[model samples]
Target: MITRDMTALRAVNGGHALLRAYDFIICGGGTAGCVVARRLAEGGKATVLLLEAGGSHHVPAIMDSTQWMWNIGTERDWDFVSEPSVGLNGRTPPMPMGRALGGGSSINGQVWARGHRNDFDSWASLTGDASSSYERVLDIYRRIENWHGRPDPRRGVGGPVDITLPESPIPLVEALIASADGQGIPSADDINTDPMEGDGGCGLPNVLVRNGVERVSMATAYLDPVAPLPNLHVLVGAEVERIGLRGSHVGSVVFRRFGQRYEVEVIREAVLSLGAINTPKVLMLSGIGDPAELASHGIPCHHALRGVGENFQDHILLGGCIWEYETPELPRNNAAEFAFFCKSDASLPTPDLMPVLEECPFASEVTARQFDLPVGPASAWTLAPGLARPKSRGRVRLRGADPALVPAIETNFLSDPDDVRALIRGVEICREIGNDLRLAGFRRREVMPGALRGGDLEMFVRNASGTYFHQSCTARMGRPDDPLAVVDPMLRVLGIEGLRVADASIMPEITSANIMAPVVVIAERAGDFIRQTHGLG
Candidate 1:
């Protein structure tokens, strides 16, 4: 039986239609989309419509924090595969994104890192929004998170997203921490609350997990609210086709479900949260992208937005040595072995540590380079060094006029020599952190990937490098003079009005850490942007 909340969303025609003209039409009811939808609907400030490409998240596996990734390649995933990469010796990469109501947050490892303040400030500098200041962003961050495990004045106590440290830790983790201390890297009691830069020690990493489960995703925190708001509607299994534009302003979006296509006109504005890969595709389908590329695909250019699919950036990673544990039993649940944050050139204050039990891989080498790292053999304890600021540019182009066809994504990973050098540094740091004598009691010899010894180090890097899977910036935001920019500082797709992209796609540069938190922050700010524009705030 459909709950009252869902029944109120159903249209008279058996669809979800809450208002004659929705104040906001949010496409892709994923991470950022849900937050925006929930906030807008909470106070009945506006009628919000949220459309999702995939269906419900009621399955037991989806809620299981440890086995959530098993949902990959299943029915609920977009299952996007990247174009062949020149960097990975011509192998293609598989990028599994969440298609359910919560988007990737529903199936991610649930690790939560707010990243560095400089990352947000850099975006503000480019966008020219002084309000994008670090302090302001921190305010938004604190407002959204409900830290449960410990008392942190820096952490918000009552928010939708539940943040906490690991419930179960491996013995190796203790050793890694000791090793960091041994190296004079002071322990940062709370990395999430501490400063992003400077000589700092490792802290107990936080995650978007609660009661050993994932939380703060779109469905859990946003869509699960009580009904009768009278302005919000959610539709699942609805795939957006294109955004219909009226001259310079977007009029509505056309989407399809169950062999029937419908168009919903937006009285005010529309937001796209289809992630970095699909946002540009949606734009090009709606006749926005590089004029030459669109024209080649028989799409008469409505706008010659040359940068619509440019400025792509992502973090390339290498796996660490899978040393056997004295306990000798593989962890039954999803617990990070540890995490590490390192520099691009292996020269930094110190590496922030993370423990990971899973890794992202592809069937071929071609797809892995989209993030600018060569598909090489390397391993770490999930130590990832993101290409915080990348110089290389890539594109997302329509395969055809068929909106059903996913746009072909090409990320020229390692196009810049600097990205590769940083990843190499990451590999070295992982080895050092992994083999620290402080954790020696748990260290068994190298297992699956083999030892990282003299002649084998290069081979490990060449064979082991993989994607951190945080792809972004295909529709980058920057100053108007920035040649490769797709959106203005306000995140409005340039040359287009009444339309905005709020997912990771609009990031000027990928953050140095996981992106779930930053994406939500973008949505929070964008919600305000929409409200202020409409005089509703």
Candidate 2:
């Protein structure tokens, strides 16, 4: 009974009419949810209901490019904190996720990085699906991007997402690229293209900003245009509790809005694009996870999918190698713009280290206190070395049956010895680039880990270590025979019919760069599968 009026559909807080059933119910109006909902509803072949736990994405802090950081810890953010990590000297770091309509795309750094070719190739190998290969994923990328830079056959034009290189990159950014080039990492015209396919390279990254001013999130690019569609209904502030299943098939979605509980039937499918954490939490709550874990929460297991919350992965970034600027320069574009991808060791097959240049000093609280770093953004710059291919794995578990409580998150960052070794090498590479002769004019002094080596340097990496906000791989896709596989190659949840996951949680492995682009690819592919399955044009 939801109306199709554009203004009325902006955000239905409460007191909105509810239809008995919809052709599709997409939970969590995040990046993937926005894309899937648009695709399913635009064909006019079906009715779709998109539910978002948070409010709208029209806030100034989310729209303005420079004010992106301001959204963290605000009402728009799901300020999740990880348990104390033994690797970081028992520190519990904050893991902020966007709760607004656009999800992380609204509050993220806006770096548009289509992961390396190997990242997708590995997915193909794991799921035994050629469509998941790099060649196929590249085609999808081409079809989705509205590239603003020099025309290239590898990139798409006239697509929904506006992608562009920094129009006027600050001098230091150029110097950082030069410094990286001097250290054997060649600079490329566009890192998302041919550069990422090879071993690795440095370049000015593409951003999801329009006219170098406003952020073009997935919600803006995909959802907003189709908001007026009569078949599509969007509900904001609707937090889903669980998926109601009739035996093996998902029948309905139960959610809470304004402290009122409601259940809406799903005529065809129920897609969960609720991110890495919430996706598995919802599944487990619906009696679809490990049997013992569900029993502990006093919930009976309807389906025993042991991989519901396992294989959790995230890119680890050390908050940085800081250098006081000789002269303060105003930040341009996304504050953290320039980036380089490279191998920590020569023997490694692909690039494992991704160091991004932050236009301001970026550090963890522990590292900042340990180093006594400057707080002013204009005073210094940071080269945050991120572990692109971390071997360590973690898991998410339910605290209790209550849907209101946050799930227990175990990031387990830097738990693997190899991860520590790789990060140490990454820090060395960052230090070498920060002090290179090409950056002499910009560097006043090296702030932290100046000459530390051996155990001291390792300690620095641990203290500075934090998440890149690319949480994924918990409810991963794999072959049916694979015991830990939660979803199949087509993103359908194992042992559950009419239920699919189209988000970062479906990644078989963490990609070798910012995961936003890879996530969009997942969502697009999901849309294709769902469309073909139901005969939607």
Candidate 3:
């Protein structure tokens, strides 16, 4: 039995006061961090410390499923901004990352999309690990999800994360599903299962919501259960500065809490689950990046790993093709309930475009300015077309050595002409679906980008383009021989001892849909590796 005072455990200074050293230190109590902490500490074999930069995830905005978008730009968000991209007509889109306990999972749309099977197979091919194969990853998904829908062997039961389809979907949502079927994208009972393994389909999405009202974030599902364990210590408002090194092995971790600096020794290992941006930023600050880049910031290089922050990738969504509703229907569940995945070109091997039907109006600042959009709570819908597998890649770089300074992110969205072409086709598909005869009873009028063609369509795609908030691949995993591989197949950071990265940052390629499910799988696999290595089982 574990014993720890609950009130004191959450205080900013409580963690350092409790212990100066821990068996394992997990940074960033986000999605992966929470999962890793629970898996490691639940065995009662390791003393784990989970440090989160932001406060708690108990806020209303994080708990309410309908208000998921309300968390963006709030205190819970990291509120990162990208460098101005010429691809978007010199626009610097705001990149919102969750700083709280649940990280992106706390504030995201809660869509439980397990990306296409090809996505995982690609990772298996790159890393030469059968564990990453689609069949194996599917087994992991089945083990983690506590599905609420009808019985299906493909899904699991009695797991930590509760997943369910939208109950009592609005009539407009039903019409949209019908419209998708009319447009050659057939409807399926569930999108998370077989639909993802095939060519393309549409249906109500599985959301990370429990009891139809509460949001089920990784913190709530995983961390909250094991939080009282004596072997587990959770510290909120703890901003990691950098990792201190002893020779080539991790020595200790330094972080700031309530304006006070504290250092804690790491007896076993340190895992970086700080998402893509902060993970690389932390590495560069600790002198574990490219020698030239570290020297440019006046920092001595401890480990000259060239690929600290390269290969940045994010899903780009054009927000979007809008339609006015014939009658008002308030949003339900997570607001965006229905979605479809398809290929931009028939020649493509798998589905590369994923467009979702938002219950409310959705548009980027530039797009909203360019078009006359609905205002003042008018009933409307948006078919936001997204490019799932982008050909273009971006990189994250350091602005300075100070941890307080935000890292410079170059999103480079739509930089490649192929991405622009695919998005143009995607927008066209969205328009067709929005105007399908099956949706005639619900759609009043087409609002934006009506009958546009050629340069105008391409321009629309550029102006409407923005991130889906699925930022990944900054420090990807690959075979050791791969030059750009930052972590090994087992997620161990190359050239660094007692250090591993187990978040979306390790994704070799961004998945073909929302990445929350895939990220959980990554954390699960990382936990298994850690336990197997230390004989924790």
> Can you write out model 2's per-residue Cα lDDT over 1-537, one digit (the tens) per residue?
222223323335233455668899999999999999999998799989999999888878899887787788998888999988898889888888889999999999999999988999999999999999999998999989999988888899988999999878888888888889999999998998776899899999999987677899999999989887778888998899899999999999988877777788899999999999999999999999999999999999999999999999999988999999899876777888799999988888889999898888888988888786866878899999999999999999999999999999999999999999999999999999999998999988898879898988888889999999999998999999988899999999988899999999989899999999999999999999999999997
TM-scores of all models?
0.88, 0.97, 0.97
Question: Tens digit of lDDT per residue, candidate 1, span 1-537?
Answer: 111123234532235444545678999988888887876677776778888888876667777776765787898778887787776555566777898888988877777777777777778888898877677888888888888766776678788777777766645566677775665555665667553654334645677666665444557876776334557778888888889889989988887877667677788889999998888888988998888888888987898778887777776655444554444433323445345444443354433333243322211242133223322222212333334444556777788987778778787766666555555555555556656777667644534343455445544454555456677888888888887788876778888888888899998877767788889888998888877777775
| Highest lDDT against the true fold, candidate | 2
lDDT of each: 0.68, 0.90, 0.88
Candidate 2: clashing residue pairs, number: 0
lDDT of 3 at 14: 37
In Å, residue 91's CA in model 2 sits off its true spot by 1.1
Q: What is the lDDT of candidate 3?
A: 0.88
lDDT of 3 by residue, 152-222 (tens): 88889989999999877778878888888888898998887777988889999998877666899999999
Q: Give stretches of model 2 more than 4 Å off.
A: 1-16
Residue 292 shift from truth in candidate 3, angstroms: 0.9
Give the lDDT ranking, best first: 2, 3, 1
Candidate 3 lDDT at 511 equals 95
